[model samples]
Target chain A: MATHGKKQDNRSPADWWLFVLGFVLFAAVGFWATPAILYAEKPQPFQFSHKLHMEQVGEGCQSCHAFREDGSYTGIPSLEKCKECHGEEPMGETPEEKVFSKDYVAKNKPIPWQVYSKQPPCVFFSHAAHVANAGLECASCHGDHGDTEKLRTYEYNRLTGYSRDIWGWSLIPLDGPPKRMKMDDCAKCHRDNGVRDACFVCHK
Target chain B: MSSSASEMRFGMVIDVDKCTGCGACSVACMSENNVGVLPDETDKIRSITWLRVYQIDNGQPYPNTQIAFFPRPCQHCAGSQGHHTPCVSVCPATATDRDPKTGIVSQIPTRCIGCRYCVAACPYHARYFNWYDVPWPEGMDKPLSPFVAPRMRGVVEKCTFCFHRYQRAQNKAFTSGEAMGEMDYQTACTEACPSGAITFGDLNNPEHKVHELKKSPYAFRLLERLHTDTAVYYVSAREWVRRQADNYLSGEKLAKVQAGGGH
Candidate 1:
């Protein structure tokens, strides 16, 4: 009823029920939006300055992850590969290096550095296609790891094996358009670029 | 000037009649291809043997028994009148390709991710996988042929029809401006045989030894009904040794093959 016409005084019971339903929907979304922690995401073991490594140190990604002659990639540097440069312990001259050497590599045990960039074999993620072909920057998927000295830990859901903050999109990327890697985002990119997008090409 | 344009199909002829099952072919093939050995070769099922020499029993008693050694390799089939050979059709990567020029099946290990699909597809059991990283005692790597690349930990490898020899032949042909004639590329097993039991050349090439040998009265292919159109053909004067090549339902397959090579 219009107020200018002055037709009706009381609203219907159905309108009140509808109001309740809308309120309930809103509350449920807010609740789901709350951050759910997976594995207690923590800072990396030690602060690694990629800026010092890349721009100042003049080292590249291939320095750590070596490529095979057959075009397949293998991450993680071998102990012997590292000893080639640091045999006399040149890098370990610093306090941080001393700590890394004393705790991790001195005893022949390799560092179990956690990598967020790694994906499962079931999901085919090729750095070659993305970086070499599409001309995408490293910062696109990795976010801003170069700027930051220390790696931060976020809670990861064990069952799903994804970060809890990303799962709900509350703690991380709260203000961004769509948080977490969704299939639709990939589909949109593929559709824009006129690629075959065959299931076996990526999925298999 | 046009050497093999008359007829060209690369093939092999094995004389089981002369074969003593001496296992020289197996040793020669392994040494030539750089096939690795396992400590536990006791389990022949899982072990990698590109050329497995089977010792067939005649099932006779009272000194009437006979035995023969049959050395098998990658069939390099032309298919049934050029249909689908089992291993070639199933490979997803398109790594292996049948040479249209020579009719030889080639193995591309660099492309193989050790999926092991081709391993199961072969009924003759030709393909092998590198389960462990290849290791040499101390000084053996230098002796390996530079033409044959040592395979890494993860991949499938098979007989290459001694492709290095073909490359050498082609190199010679290119330099001399002469064609790569038949018998120019022979397998190591063929050359290593003391009794000259093995013949290697193109089956399609009429001038080649293999082509003429394939038309022999006793010439027959392994698993002909399966229709691999295998480049490797066997000649046996005996009936029972011929029967051992493939599975037959009574007189069905034998009758067909016998009719042709029977004379």
Candidate 2:
């Protein structure tokens, strides 16, 4: 009985590393597979640089993502907006601009840009309230996308069809807007700011 | 439960005598709110309507009979003490709430779990449960207003007093850096009333018409004794019409009371 107990103790201590190995392996697999399995990526219509456009436009982000006279944000710039700056000729010598000129600009077709921050149909986000009324910076909610040279790959949930930005890029639910934009994040901000967090305020 | 001084109490006061029971208000309410139309809407048990007009008649002999129409919408109850609105309190999912800022009862169908508790708790029968997913006919979905989200089956919906219009008006006000005028926000039914029987505005604002109209001696709310503290009011000179608004004991009678007096 004494020999058996001693043997069991020795085996248990040695096998503790195996349990640690299994846990690490499983956690790593989970961290890798979760995003890959749940999300599907779609490319934007063509490459366009906000950095390049930002240099030429007088009004920062409003020059392209303009608000209508009624205060509604015109989310994506229409083809007519692009026509204001670029005519039949390609603005830049890049192949992307060549494709934009031939396929979209010259054809007068609207670019089917994949929106990264497009919310669910149920959410009624008023840019006028956030931007005009509260005077919130665009970068406050939407990271530094305007400063990026190239558009990032748009990833959306396979089940809900919502952009990954809505749930956020982090697998660990530890961050708020600019990293994640879930309902709780919004409520938290509203609560902190002494804003009315009524359901109808955000939801239609 | 009284609102703070700065809070706006959006309400409506309808002159029942001027209402011809034409149902234009009901029609306008449905289109404005995107209330579904069923193939067999004649089946009142299953049909949904945001604004329902009840036909009431004076119980008089052949030569004296007179009828009046009561266009009923969600009362936007402030409850007995102010915050205990029957439907809002009974909602287990917190799908419905009375907005303290606007005093408008807001129902979020997406958050509703189809419990039907709110539908049963409402004394005014203002809430309706959607039984089926509304199948918009070919080309019918195109004209749907982008402001209001279409509710799916298994949720309760009711009148919002055209809150989306208020949201739009607020957006315009935000842009113009000006306060929202009385005419800036009006419900579709109020605008559609041919006889101008329905007057909608912030009842607390003295500058608006409804603030004064609701104070008339003829004004009364439905089930006032129950103390729902509803935002909607009705005015009728006829004794029978005011009597029909609430239940009374055999010898009991409705006393002449100033509207907005409960607040």
Give the residue spans of candidate 2 off by over 4 A.
Answer: A1-24, B1-5, B256-263
What's model 1's lDDT at A48? 63
**Candidate 1, B-chain TM:** 0.91
DockQ agreement of candidate 2 with the native complex: 0.47
Which residue pairs of candidate 2 clash? B1-B81, B1-B82
Per-residue lDDT tens digits for candidate 1, residues B49-111, read 777778887778858998877878788776775677677778899756676656767667766
In terms of lDDT, model 1 sits at 0.66
Best by TM-score: 2
TM-score of each: 0.55, 0.92
lDDT of 1 by residue, A139-192 (tens): 665566665665556445566665443333444333321244443445556777
Candidate 1: deviation at residue B50, Å? 1.8
Regions more than 4 Å wrong, model 1? A1-204, B1-7, B251-253, B257-263
Model 1: how far residue A191 lies from native, Å = 29
The TM-score of candidate 1 is 0.55
